[model samples]
Target: MEVKQNNLIKSLRIQPLIVVIRLENNFFNISDKRENLLLKIEKLSNCGIKNIEIGWDSNPEWVNLILQIKKKFKSINIGVASITSRQSLDSIRSLDINYSMSPYFNKEIHLKAIKYNQLVIPGISNIENFKEAINLGYKIVKIYPASKLGVKFINELQGFKKKDMFFIGAGGIKSKNLKSLLKLGYDALVIGKELRNQKPDKDLKIWLKNC
Candidate 1:
């Protein structure tokens, strides 16, 4: 199933514009972590790029560093990520972040994020979790291993929603699948290894244009 091109989304959203940066892998200058994060955030800001999600579950220092990033770059939106880790709202309530996401969902974490009024995108790979999130008031859902399931399945899910719900795709995203994601019903995407090899700035711009 393909979207019939909604004029509202075309006008309001820069479709296919979500950039998910694995803070650990993308910013590889591990010698000085804080400085590394600042440099990446500042560079992206200088490039006139905005919207970034930083993943952290064990790196509590990331919470503080992200605050500094927000202070330094007011235009950028910061998000937190937890995958198969113990990241919880207790860890993030003090630090300022826009959202909390996981490659899979947990009832406790989801409930906590909701209480904090933090946007949460729980990952679900199958129909049961999908139905549960929809029933539990999730506006955004992450589709893990998006490359394996591919855009075809996402297109099928799009048919069930009345409004455009956020269907975020991760894993195995590349230049080849970018167009198909847009053609399908996915609302956003995250990348890691794809950006690690490219001229980050140029490739991002080219991707933005295509999305």
Candidate 2:
């Protein structure tokens, strides 16, 4: 299904927590690793996580796994991240992913996703990149390395030019500061490392209850 921007906006407005799983480079090491990851996704889904982005790697096996999950789950929005090359697009085209995410604000990638009728979100690291993305008609954007940029930087942009702009805070965001970042006006939060490393199901239950 081709996901529209308005539909994505509505979904985000209702559920703003985006769990980003950075697939370990050594994911294939464990036996039944594919099932393990899918089980993790099931736990997250049962906890009411409506959105998830598989980031960090874009291997074919991972792409196939996404397709399999998408077929089984009817409610979740599955997205593939780190789409920077045409080869990446071709590799996962059959997956029919709900959306695409990038770690950089590249016009080529953005346009390519659009051409494929997919909702695309670009990551912006600075005011300049943010401006360029907004000018290109991207309403939803991810603020990468939020920890480095600090809450003060976000507060300063409260009166941004684009009133409809929505920001997803990612990179170095942990359980300790997730609530604070959400309160600071980040439309959504992308969590990793801290939330998924040990006992993700237990952590997600506690974290989401507070949200």
Candidate 3:
């Protein structure tokens, strides 16, 4: 049988929008609020967003929720982000996850993820880490805490990079500024905490369209 392509990278080739759903205390409440979470994802899907990140917060049960989402939305590329250790990769790998991302660059962690044949996107900020990631053949990377770095930094980095490395703008991303970042040529955006709104269905619909 032919092996399938990694969904995260495949989705990027299709579009550059990603909705990051953080499984925080909400994971504990998923049993009761499952439909609401599903609805939020459904709204994003309907709006043409096909990639999502399930922010891992040290909760093992969170993988179960990811499995559920994958089963329900076969076309959506679901990945676990905020990874820091080999253990996190192991857990996600056990679930047959095809993609993952970390908040910072770590050679060991990157190697381990590669060993699992996972499409690993490491966080990059300054020139040094970005160079190292590219040296390791990472074509796509995440610009984390982008709110702190601001749009100017991203513009400057994109202007000076060796190759056209795709960037996923994450950390403190909001619906208001998402379009501006996209206009600035960010390859993708990962919206998390701020997305858990009282009106997720309406908000997601608008946000996805705005992007």
Candidate 4:
């Protein structure tokens, strides 16, 4: 688990950005939706995206979809996100994914992840949760609703940051503000809705080139 965690940290440092892809329910046209998703991922791969997180779903076919994605895109680092329940954890356990993430910290969920030897990065919104995450042996954490917290919130936590600790800023992150946020303190940023809502804009394309 330690080695896997370290590898993920190292990969994040090199790329420093994770594009999250959330699939909406389209029970009637699941096949078309899956194809659309593949095309979107191909576009991201062309844009030099190195990491991606697919939101977990309760649908039985979700696991097979992930397997297909992994087989199709071997180069990109794939992770599961929105893992907030025991069922969600169990769903991905057999997938052999390198890491997964929860939107908020849950002691029971996190402990179960450890027992399974899966690296689940906990999400923390405040000092209290952040401290608890550290105590649980987490070196990587996500700051959800990062824009709401602002740069000052992360900067203030610098004093408490442990060596090798990694911070991933998510929610309300735009291509324009990405660099500034990373400079402020976040080790990486997660861009989801913005990219999914529209094609990768010029600024994002330029940024990916340098990344």
Q: Candidate 4 residues 90-111, lDDT tens each?
A: 9998899988889898999999
Scored by Cα lDDT, where does model 2 land?
0.73
Model 1: ten consecutive residues of lowest lDDT:
1-10
Q: lDDT for model 1, on a 0 to 1 scale?
A: 0.64
Q: Stretches of candidate 4 above 4 Å error?
A: 27-29, 196-198
Q: What's the residue-level lDDT of 131 in candidate 4?
A: 94
Instruction: Write one digit per residue (lDDT tens) for candidate 2, span 87-165.
Output: 7766667776666678778888777777776666888877787777777777888888788888876775555647877
For candidate 2, give the lDDT of residue 138. Answer: 77
3 or 4, greater by lDDT:
4
Off by over 4 Å in 2: 1-3, 26-31, 56-58, 201-203
How does candidate 3 fare on TM-score? 0.83
Of the candidates numbered 1 and 4, which has the greater TM-score value?
A: 4
| Local accuracy by lDDT, each model | 0.64, 0.73, 0.73, 0.87
Clashing residue pairs in candidate 3, if any?
none
Give per-residue lDDT, candidate 4, residue 164: 77
Top candidate, metric lDDT: 4
**TM-score, every prediction:** 0.79, 0.86, 0.83, 0.96
Which numbered prediction scores highest in TM-score against the true structure? 4
Which of 1 and 2 is ahead in TM-score?
A: 2
- The clash numbers for all candidates, in the given order, read 0, 0, 0, 0
Q: lDDT tens string, model 1, 139-204?
A: 567898888887667877776654746677887777556666756766767765676522255656
lDDT of 3 by residue, 75-183 (tens): 7887777789877777787677666789889989887777777666888878788888877777778998788888878887787675656788888887667667788
Clashes of 2: 0
